[model samples]
Target: MTQRIRELLDGAVADLEPGVSDPVAAVVRRGRAARRRSVLAAALVVALLGGGLAAGRQLVTTAREPAPAGPAELGRPPVPRVVGRTVVAGAMRLPIPDGWTAVENDPSRPCGDLHRTILLVVTGNRGCQNASVEVYGSERTYPGGTLVGDDLLDEDHRIVTPPVAMTLRGGEPAWMSESLEAADLAPDRYPEFAFWNVVTLPWSMVMLQLRDDGPAERKILDSIVTTPTEAGVLALPDSARSVSLTTPDAKGRNLPAGAARTKDQRTVAAVIALLRAQSDVVDDSAACADPGRPRAAVSLESATPTMVVITLGGGCQEAVSSAGGRVRLSDATLAQLKTLLGIGAR
Candidate 1:
């Protein structure tokens, strides 16, 4: 797994430790995209506890909680520093305006609804969402994941407003947008945040919960100028200085266990360009899709496989990755990839 992905899911192991109240089966079902992390967590448990159900039970019995929140808290700032009385989320800085109290979601319990949270700064908090949920981008794989296709659409299937242009941390293109509509909201409880900043690409929607027709409300809104977090990237890593293609043999039957290295510069450039340019994942059934088959598997000894192109039926460039990320390549980019792998033609 990539360092970023590992960091995102590092807490998952503790979430499954014996006496967490949440069952193993439940965590598995929810972590469809977290298969790797779950496996690693299991192996670590076996290695640490000597691989016995009885030992696992003993650990659970003595453990008061699934995991403590101290470690994460210690790593984070006690409070984000504010400048000019404005808090910028993309900067990971919180602006506490008078009565507002800013708090980061617990690493283990990120998806849970905030309790009495005034101003919140969400960083790398993601989860599977079904039914009605208060969080933004819940339907997507995660921030900067899943293809936005032609336009950004809301969970209601309604077309969201065009995205406000932004940049990724790498200075790559990205967007910001609104999330839940007021109608999509469940009953408002304590810490019921009135605003949310979600990240999706191509075009993004931005939603504000507070009404602004009233003069005072507009004044309040204008007082605190903020921006959403910069998008994450699926681009290939520099460590991936070499590339290889694993494919089936002459009969097109028994695929070899080993991969052959490709020294062709065109092929290398194409692969890197495709990965660098890509920023989408797809699952559209039939609505305007470009499709392509993965003729060969990529073997990058240096970098973790962040994403792989999937058959999206929309474009040959679309792909799904190990981290559930989707990337859409251009027709030319797809053509280059196809040629390098000897898919259709070189």
Candidate 2:
């Protein structure tokens, strides 16, 4: 192929000899230049994909926050430029080097774009991740909802690395693991990324596909920073301060959403007290599992909430909790409790 191209170019150059300064020499110089370019291009690819510069990576910057800027390269899905010395991915704030940039997005879409850039995943998938240097937030959280952690261990990937846990400089938790779920793409293609990572926060999580768990990766991992709201965590219900219940939006009923909420101190204390009492009557979870109609939940809030579920008038006329095995409620007690909370029939 090279010989044929050279012969054609050499002839063309010879035909334009009058204008061409040393046609034979010119062809030779052009051929050499093209060869050098091809060699350099191949080398760049190998360096980018082969080892990710994970070993000799010494890029650590503390420049001011980057201002929004245009694409670094001109093309579709333009290359993300390292606009600042610092990067804000999901919940992490880490130093970025001169050559690299981040391609940030939620987990709802596949994360297989731009091998050269880091894939930052915020929020988390419902279950395990299929190690694609990426995992996603839950379907209920991130946009698009198509790509998630449970995608699968398909042919697009055949490697698995054991999961590990680590903490950032300030004490935020992080994690990563390989998945083995049956992705719907059993034998086909999916738009989202074919790779993954994992982490969990009070309401959401943040993750990055590391070139390796070495210093280059650690620099980013060590500087994670986020509040629960920043991580998109849902606010928790204050079970200790209030007694609350939810009911189906049944047709013909006049009740509204959150109709069963109370902050009455005595009522809250009474509900908590009843749940804490132990009884000889053992409750069958299977029987209580389908407790129909009226149900109640009373919580004692703290760093963690203690909650109890109750059945009113059903065969499973009892209240149960993790701390209290089973406290069967007598008919009189049930009636008194109903009067206290003002919960009515469906």
Candidate 3:
């Protein structure tokens, strides 16, 4: 069959004129066409291989990288530019750090023998673990001298460092100590530093305790404000025109006629002195008796009829009803006032 096709091709070529049909030209054209086809096939294969390589590289890079951080993973909340703000805690106004939040004692929890007359606990979310500032006062009397050596040591608290003498805002003597053991009331044993300010007015001791001795803690301690005593409030010029003490009779009725009213300068001075020796002003709203049926009443009349200051008492609980609001009085302050008025102790 090959021989027969060759003979046929030769016969067809022989029939044509040599100059009209050129076999060499036709052979060269076919050769160029085959080379072009081969080049086009190779180019298509290379294009496909390069695309696969690029996609594989992208997948590998993505698997090796880490996920971005979220808000919680960043740790602490941002601190505000301003540092402190004055806030009223009980009767005393104090300055607290800006980002810190106040945590009040839970009323439902039992506080046995813990005379927290003015308690303020503050905490902040600044990356420090278990950091807090606690300011409180106890009803028990603390000796004037070295608090860390005398009081804390007696209580079995292991003092990690020596106490440093310092002065509070009003020139009151204070002692600071760092300890390894926790307080009697603490839930856990943790290292702590404390500042004890000895005050005579209330015959009680005030304390500020911090978990960590960091710069943030120091800033908060520096912002503390000295609160005015009850005597200071009463000593203001023209505090009251007259002061009276009233108590309930056998029938639980307030005896106006039997009440003692004192306008004498000497008696007023004595009463003021007595109050100054006792507890400082504190918020007593939570412990006050009913406004209508108080156990005892100490009324201070001013020139203006509306400016009357009435202090109602029921046992250790006492509230001062004034224009601002009804607030609790310190225990010692109420007790001393009762003694001066000839009202028997509860």
Clashes of each: 20, 16, 1
232-320: candidate 3 lDDT, tens digit per residue: 22221123444556544566444333346555444444443443333344332222232233344444444321111233434434333
State the TM-score for model 2: 0.28
Task: Please tell me which model should have the higher TM-score, number 1 or number 2.
Answer: 1
Better of 1 and 2 by lDDT: 2
What TM-score, over all chains together, does every model reach?
A: 0.29, 0.28, 0.25
lDDT of 2 by residue, 318-337 (tens): 54442223455665654444
Residue-level error in angstroms, candidate 1, position 272: 1.7
Q: Cα-based RMSD of the predictions, in order?
A: 16.9, 29.4, 43.9
Candidate 3: clashing pairs of residues: 284-328
Q: Is candidate 1 or candidate 3 better by TM-score?
A: 1
Where does candidate 3 stray beyond 4 Å? 1-239, 276-287, 291-293, 304-316, 321-346
Provide the global lDDT of candidate 2 against the true structure: 0.32
Kindly provide the TM-score of model 1 when superposed on the true structure, using C-alpha atoms: 0.29
lDDT of 1 by residue, 305-326 (tens): 2223233223343443322234
